[model samples]
Target: MKKLLTYIIIGSACFSACKKTEEQLYTAQDNIYFDLNFKDLSGNNRRMDSVMYSFALFPEKSVDTVWLPVRIAGMRRSEARSFRIAVDEKATTAEAGKHYKSLEKEYIIPADSGVAKVPIILFAADPALTSKSVRLKLRLVPTEDFTVTNPEYDSAKVIFSNRLEKPAWWATWQGELGNYSRVKHELFIRAAGVNELPVAFDAQVLPKVLFAIRRFKNFLASPISWVADNPQEGYTLEPAGAGKYNFFSITNPGKKYLLELNPADNRYYFTDETGARIV
Candidate 1:
């Protein structure tokens, strides 16, 4: 009887201890509710900031989706919470089903979770995007569980662009290259019959000009005189707009010449030493 009594007492104490702990946890949970914010692509939530998703693609490009995540700061709950998203039509340039798939109206922050994602799939090799960039502005609405803490970053901007983007090198000496902007660069690349063009500099071979040499022969219908100098060097040229080649001729400095890809003649024409077309 004594042994049975001891076991019963121990069991009763354990039950009360469990009940007390449960109540404590519930009370703690009730005291906490955290601010909700949009997480950047890096998964860090420093501020509720607008998100930008940008991409460039070539023909026969593969389609892909960019995921934007939302985050909350407190304890996880068993019940799901919903957040609302609406397209800001006045601010958006992308049409639904053209640049991106239309986003759903609501996304759920799943039970016991602090983060959720909204997937935006951008179509690949979009011919329209080649000439221009399409923008989709998405605004987050006030929900029962969450409100915008910062008005500035309460929306998202999605840009689907395939236009040629100038390389990082241009940030320093773009003016010398005839103020080559992204659009101009895209035009040059497209005319050259290439998807992309990269600028390369080598002090050993030529320091003043950036050289990107490759299968120009395949792209061009016929050969030019410059091919004798370096067959690989003149495959594609960026007429740094204003009728000037993108490269500074090593043999001629401080003098920029005009290079035109003459589709009619099936040849590239550049002004020679005497300002005559060297075909």
Candidate 2:
């Protein structure tokens, strides 16, 4: 009976301990993480600790920005909240201001957002980057507003350089801009304001395209003037109307042939009264 009582006491103690642990687990705080496995401006998702950047890709830009993503693993709140990040100086090789702009004291995760991005501003005008790459490491610090749950994503790194090199995809776009040269590439970046073509256009693109179409319609609606090359030979070409033409022939005074300009090819061709092309 004494042994039985001892077993009951031990079992009750174990059950109580387990119940306490389960309650604590249920009440554990939701946390934020860097979500290193994320997508950037290129829209390609990569699981990496460090991101690489080059200023040469945007030669005309004095500064550039790339967004690093952070995510929350639990329920979102109704209001925006701030989080903390700091430069891990010992792990960083890039200089502040010269290599990269200083980060804000805090970043915001909008209300109801499961994910957020921290913008990393990189200096493109640094001459040293042309010769060597510099590194910047940023650590996610726990604050009253946020706490890091995963040690793996507690920090992120970026390696950057100003050295310009022709992108591999240049092979596909070279013909559109002609041969690639340092000067030409810079000009292309300046003119286009982007390193790559925008493959996916949003709603804003439609209005500009429509505006261009309107301009083109105005051009087509306007009359085109063509002069008879040999006016001395009694050949006079005048605009009759769209699809109709009048050509004055001296030899056959009553024989009228319509001369029309093909805007598609910017060439002139003669058509008979029946609208058949005269070869």
Give each model's clash number: 1, 0
Name the best candidate (by lDDT): 2
TM-score each candidate. Answer: 0.47, 0.52
lDDT tens digits, residue span 1-279, model 2: 999999999999999999999887666665888887858789998779999887656443557788899887766878888888899999999989887889898988898887899999987655566678999999888777677878887889999886556666556544444455543343343223345543444577646434533432332232132223323434444568875556543543333345577787765555332455433
- Model 2 lowest lDDT segment of ten: 218-227
User: Would you give me the overall lDDT of model 1?
Assistant: 0.55
| Model 1 misplaced regions, further than 4 Å | 1-55, 58-62, 124-126, 170-279
For model 1, which pairs clash?
216-235
For candidate 2, what is the TM-score? Answer: 0.52
* Candidate 1: worst-modelled 10 consecutive residues by lDDT: 212-221
lDDT of each: 0.55, 0.65
